[model samples]
Target: MEKIILASSSPRRKEILNRFNLNPLIVEAKIEEKKSYNESPEQVAMALAFEKALWVCNKFNNEEVVIGADTIVVLGNRILGKPKDEEDAFRILSLLNNKEHSVITGISIIRANTNIKIIDYESTLVRFRHLSEEQIKRYINTKEPMDKAGAYGIQGYGEVLVEKIDGCYSNVVGLPLGRLDYLLNKFFNIKIL
Candidate 1:
């Protein structure tokens, strides 16, 4: 088995990988996550994921496979990342109330000692139930929305706000297992399970 490196600090991603029975070396990738003007949500995510993977790849042996990922919530053309503060979280939740949004996650994999690279993205549509200001505030007070895109986490208390979803639930949480499985199989011939 090839040494696997996860170049992210997201607990959600780590948990998802663990659920697949894969344990990876965790390495935080320090990269500036700035969005490019006029870039599509998918492009922004892939770019950030690539940057993270490249950063970690430079620090490890070539025999390792470095994986990086970025996720964002898109409502119309607006992209919602992690909230800067509780106030921001409240505002994001307000906008998402009773609305459908898209969750886009970009994934990148790089061979540790080689120049091999792969990048792809998955998008999931999620609908939020009508939420009162009190409900949003209560959820925000829990602080669960502070660190998640769109001020909500599908696998946590944020699930209460979700009315429906039309794609991979894991993608909305952070990573898409189906997409990750395909990438691993295609590039490393590694199959989950």
Candidate 2:
């Protein structure tokens, strides 16, 4: 088995890997997301994911495989990140109300001290049911939206707010485990199952 490192601090992402019975070394890659003016959502996500993986790999020069991922909620051309406050959360949910949005997660897997790398993205279409103000407020009171993209978490209470999803459910949760498994098998000869 190849030594694996996860370049993230997200418990959701950690749990996803845990489902595979793999306890990877968790390294927090401290890098601020600086949005480029002209980059698409896919580009932004991919670049950030790669940056995080590179950051961790640079720190430890060994035969370790590092995985980094970044996910964004996009409505039209706008990117909705984690909410700054309750008001912001309400605003995000309001925009998502009765609308179909895209959640794109970028994943990067790289081997330390080597040039082997895989950078890819998975996009999921999430449709939200029409939400009343009270419903939004109630969900906000749960505080589940504070730390999630688009101010909603499909894996938790936020699932009720979603009407349907057209793509990978795990992508909305944080990581696309199916896509991840393929990458692991393809690049590192590692398989989750």
Candidate 3:
């Protein structure tokens, strides 16, 4: 197996890869995640993922395979990012209550030694159950929503907030395993299984 480097600090992302037995080196990419108004949600996600992967790959001899990813929550044209504060978390959760939104994750893989790089994105439709103010407040107190893109983590206590999910569950957690496996196999001749 090739040496894999994960260019993210997210534990959920690392955990997902670990489940596939791809024990990757954790190399957190120290790039500012900027949201672009001109680009579509997909473009923004892919661009951030590419930026992170390229940042880490530049430090290596290019022989290592680096993976970077970004997840975003979108309600119509609005992109709901991580909450700035507890109040912000409340507002975000309130907006998403009883509404269906989209979770899009962008993934980028780079193997500069082989001159191989690929960027792709996955979208999952998530419907939030009708949440009472007390429920949102209680969930906010857990602080899980502060660092997550959607003010809720489907893998944690936030799972109760979800009424239905129409797509990849892993994508909502921060990475898209199926898409990542496909990209690895098709582009870099790598197979997790």
Candidate 1 vs candidate 2: which has greater TM-score? 2
Cα error, residue 171 of model 3, in Å, equals 0.6
Model 1 TM-score (2 dp): 0.97
Tens digits of lDDT, candidate 2, 1-193: 7788999998999999888887888999999888785999999999999999999989878779999999999999999999999999999999999999999999999999888989999999999999999999999999999999899999999999999999999999999999999999988999988
- Candidate 3 regions with alpha-carbon error over 4 angstroms: none
Instruction: Kindly list the per-residue Cα lDDT of model 3 for residues 63-105, writing each as its tens digit.
Output: 8999999999999999999999999999999999999999999
Instruction: Compose the digit string of candidate 1's lDDT tens values, residues 148-170.
Output: 98988889898899999999988
- In model 3, residue pairs whose N, Cα or C atoms come closer than 3 Å (at least 3 residues apart or on different chains), thus clashing, are none
Question: What lDDT, from 0 to 1, does candidate 1 have?
Answer: 0.91
Off by more than 4 A, model 1 = none
Better of 1 and 3 by lDDT: 3
